[model samples]
Target: MNRKTLVLPAVVGLLAPVLAACGGSDDGGDAIVVGTTDQFVASKDAPAPLDPAIGYEAGVWNVLRQTVQTLTHIPRGGGAPAPEAAKSCAFTDTENESYRCTLRDGLTFADGTPVTPEDVKYSIQRVLDIKDESGPIGLLANIDTMETKGDKEIVFHLKTPDATFPYKLATPPAGIVQKDKYPAKSAREGFQVDGSGPYTMKPEVEGDQVTKVVFTRNPKYKGDLKVRNEKVELDLFPDAAAMGKALDDKKIDMMTRTMSPEQAQSMLAKPKDGVKLTEMPSLAISYLAFNTDDPAVKDKAVRQAIAQVIDRGAVAKSVYGSTAEPLYSLIPSGITSHTTSFYDRYGEPSATEAAKILDKAGVSTPVKFTLHYTTDHYGPATKAEFETLAKQLNASGLFQVDVKGTPWAEYRPAQMKGDYAVYGMGWFPDFPDADNYTAPFLDENNFLNSPYRSSVAENTLIPQSRREADRSAASPAFDKLQDIVAEDVPVLPVWQGKQYVASLDGLTGVEWSVNSSADLQLWELGRGRDLPEDGVQGEFEEVVLGLDVPVEGHRG
Candidate 1:
């Protein structure tokens, strides 16, 4: 939901006058600077070694999206994945069992090496081979093996039918790389980023960790995207207030990571001097993930008891202040397969029922459990949100709660390794589909380092849902899956929040740059003077070519 929520018509209306004013030079000259808090990228687990197979966060993706070329590109306004690095791609038959794509002619890396079909196969296989726990290796769970046909074609044999596979390829995790440039056995730790996308990173400046990071447009890019700026700089600050102050002083032209609910609401609803707000619908969900490996939270009764006691309504209202809506299921509301399973199971907060359930299970009163959260990444509201959670659980008197927080830099890896007893989890969708919401969290080895494994979810429900090409046909399976999650309670769904980006008045393309799922398209953005009079408002040109014949490849 990182897209502007005020509808395209409303955005167009606002941009009409803004576009005219953009012709003037009052905004900033030449380079465009975007300000963000240091937590934008995890400080310790920074997106460095930014090889697609390793990094998995907005900070890394914000740069990778502009530099890495994928097989296909999902447009700003969401729809079917369009051919990008691929000339054309499709399933071999009606089964949705196998996927194939023909590489675009003359595709070359920034280093001028040919981006052959072999590189595509290598790029994907390497990720699966490395199997980085912190990476997005699980996103490719459906892919059984990959085969390459000559230099231009590649086919993916899926373990099961998955209609959403193409959407996954469009993400950074599937970015193709030359095998020679990157190591075949392990990640090339210090390899230079030589990609075929619209931009390349500028040489790192000293103290860039606390100062800034920069990217320059890649002259070798073959895609149709218009890269207007000579440079794009991400000015990093210690906190949001400093970032905001820089934006107000015109030291930075834009600010993006995320702000506290109070800061976002105040800055966006009532813009400062030359700044404007571009708000979008977000598919991001915030929740509590239990490390079922821990003895304290391993019991389902304890999880269910805690779930029944906490009030999502009070958390949403008091902590988020209308910035977020209470979530009842893993599949967020806007997606097709979403269900109110959690809400239906636990209607309204009931401490009495929780106490009774715990007592019957031989669990004593005031069950001691620790709750972990990140200090940043989700925004300043996270502190308040977790505080509210601890307060509610402690108030129930059936549980004794302890809340602790670490910076996101440390929290993510530790949580993934099941280092926390019970922790907070937030998800920003990789794609707009419900599969993205449910599959990753419920997989055999999921984002949550929980010991609650559901064979029904892994074997039957998820597979059944992935097979159907028609999304609505898959809803029943997804519904059943949600019901199981509600009963199991490995991770308790909490809230769904909106996306907000603020920028100077003259910056064109902010509205058009955000995708349906709220991923920002940095390539689509440009400085005011360079942008077209209509901004990036017009329709995207359709991809016309289609191939009926299918080719096979050598499976490793």
Candidate 2:
């Protein structure tokens, strides 16, 4: 499959809860088959070196969420961070610089080895040591060093005050791994490492490409939630169409990737007899990045003008079929501290105002610029998306647009090197927080490769916002941060999406493990002849997940 076939239409993996009806085989009592796009996996074949330190891909994180226990986890109920491996945790001081966690007693890895605070400290420190650029090491920006006080207690010393530290730990970046199985300085390449999560992968079934990897409930897992299915066979498909067809054929029970608007709409319209669709709001954002080094968009006025001229609502409706909504801020909706700063500053799409802004900057109309996007990385609608955007800008007579496409392998490196004058970028939150939106883009030498500068967001708002333990006070700081992003216009928020899944009728508890981020709790999935018309939410309880396999089962 091509890169486009690999990536889902929207951010496919994150956190979620809801209930629905779907039918499947109940022969094994509790066994379900899951179908997803192959590209979601960090490494196509197996979870080897499933080390969280180097595992940043959405698919990898999705699997890791079930296979490895973290210090904390955002509940499916969508409130504060709840304890996972940690029995109890809190900030030790008012400055929010020191965090203390007490490990739950009797915690053990898949091999039945005790999981201690020392292992927790090692898991975090090792990630920082490896420091893979493609990894989630960036999420641990606040930690200074970790201290293990006895076998049960651990404390994290932060270099700077960060109220969001606990949430960071809840992400896969802090997924605890077995110290003995993984080396301290290097990554455990392949599926050799030990994980203490809800389920264990059957090593014998692991393979490359479309091969199936079966996940069986970890008998050693100490989590409270009972596994709805004894086994979940994850089968990757080349594209959405293939995955959808398989779902209809009953070859697979569920899907994780986001479908194209056309596919989703068709699925809804046709209404398969035994299929039910469920939708959940997501924290994902798709936007355009202006390469500040490119002379065409180097000027803030030109960037701002493009932001003014581009019609997000039109693109959302025409291309995405309202599956995605216009997003005016980097911090997406459904989260506190989100603000529509771009809409406030530029109002609706306007050629007149765009022309005035360019004119005021002494730049002539009919501005020439190139827009680059990944042909297959974002989704099939990417081409239509940029084309619609080009039409909106071109029709205004304020700019002439030349749109281009590239594969993800070439596009990611190129965009980061400022090779593209302007490009499209999709963001999936590392954790559900406003800081994930700002810090990655606005910080000095951050994610965007362009030489775009925003001192207020970098020096003032971001730092101040991270320090504020109280979200209410932090909201105003984030509000200012969005306004600054609007003024600088380094990137433009095009749209925010809601997550959806299509499953056969008679399936129940599809929503039990969904946190605010759209991650599915596979353990919560099961089949039922009759389910509630008004879906019920799943209960919340923290449990330590065990590794996917026993020590002898690992194939390194």
Candidate 3:
């Protein structure tokens, strides 16, 4: 059977008090199966419309983007190209101002569009034109023009020198879209999906769990994915428990990510036979984003009170289990500019202290605010975690959290403009740099329109660091930024997560990388054994998934 026929059944994965993974066998003898705790956003909906110039989260874009070439890639060490995208990348101009890229010849889009200098030029310019709410528009704002120096050669001339230009390209927002396909202004208007990436997302079953996705050979896919499996398939689950159960039952060939930390720990303790778990340090940071712009949150007392009521440790242990660590900094440890500012200031949840902090601000009857979250963006346990936080804050007496939530679809765009007062957010690094942590959140242009609403110093430092490219010079700027973030308390950092996966034995190339944000590269995986039914099963796996999911959480 073809790749689309390989998704796990809905009954195969389920989440909740009890989780199951690797559901019923494919009935196909040789097919490889995998399980994951996350669900697909489904492609039936219109593309969220990313600005090619400004930055934003790539979301599911990563799964198929492998086929398209970028200026740089996180090559596998002792693995594939340690640097797969660009032949060699660097700041050609000493001022850290000018950036250039040289691509491998013969690289082409999934449709066979040649990866040309103009395509690269258009790709970079597209981001600027869209002016996306995410990504680094402030950084790209400096680029004066881009042109093809020659075949396979592209140059970016910045109004000012920036050493971190390469880091900007590393993000999926900067993904190379086919100029022939994507319009210059995907922001003001919808975009066509003729991307230059490795795989084109399969149309029929885009977002549903067990949806259809196929990664074909990019004859021009000279990027790193070639080193792995050529074809890729992704199966989504409503919750992690179902994903885990599927893995235990051997329903799927490999698993990308699973449910809560405790669940992950249990899987690691007694993994299903032949199933392997790969763990990597994650750049992801979890937070409770406060709308500093909110009149209620604008009061320092209320913000600090909410921050005080949160017990990061409890949230980590209760929902994440041992799979994640309590995080107090926007910048995770091991990354530069990390600090214990939040931890040092709050120490731990203290109702008495929180009350005092509010009283000192002069208005202390009791503060209340709705803690908003979304059902889809993060995962299932998210609602539980938010409720857990609400309980803790209410118990503190100094504050009361009225929990509210939206479906992920509506919630994402609302939070991007920083509209939500206190909403949950997970930050996957744009680039593995401290600057990414500080800059994206503060620059007036960042996703959360919070900009300088809370801290002017932060606004100054982000640009200060970006201009200088020197790590040492950037350090103090980031240092002060972290400290101010903690003091202002616009957003509360909760945990730094560890990337985990449980895959069947037949699967290979289960890599652990700092880049790729530890994303599963489906192309590198396939069935070790042949299907029992062969090509005749046609596409049972996908057919089953495309079926309705009962509200009772059973197969429709």
Candidate 2 lDDT over 278-308, as tens digits, reads 6766776788888788888888899999999
- Greater TM-score among 1 and 2 belongs to 1
After superposing candidate 2, which stretches have Cα over 4 Å from the reference?
1-30, 38-50, 191-193, 202-210, 224-226, 529-556
Which model is ahead, 1 or 2, in terms of lDDT?
Answer: 2
Tens digits of per-residue lDDT, candidate 3, 1-556, equal 0000000001111111122233332233332334444434433342433223422443343442444456654433321112345555555665666666676656566676677777777876877776755444554666898867778777778775555666556545556777656678764222224455555554234333334334443444455444333444445566666765655565555555435555667767887565556565555666777777677687867777777778889888887776668888877775656778887888877878887887888875667678888675565667788888888887876666799889755776676566677877766654556766776667556556664453465446665776765455567887788888888887688877666544544455444211224344445444343223222111111111011111110110
In terms of TM-score, the best-performing candidate is: 1
TM-score of each: 0.87, 0.86, 0.80
Per-candidate Cα lDDT values, in order, are 0.67, 0.69, 0.55
Better of 2 and 3 by TM-score: 2
lDDT score of model 1?
Answer: 0.67
RMSD of each: 6.8, 7.1, 10.1
Better of 1 and 3 by TM-score: 1
What is the C-alpha local distance difference test score of candidate 3?
Answer: 0.55
Provide backbone clash counts, one per model. Answer: 7, 31, 57
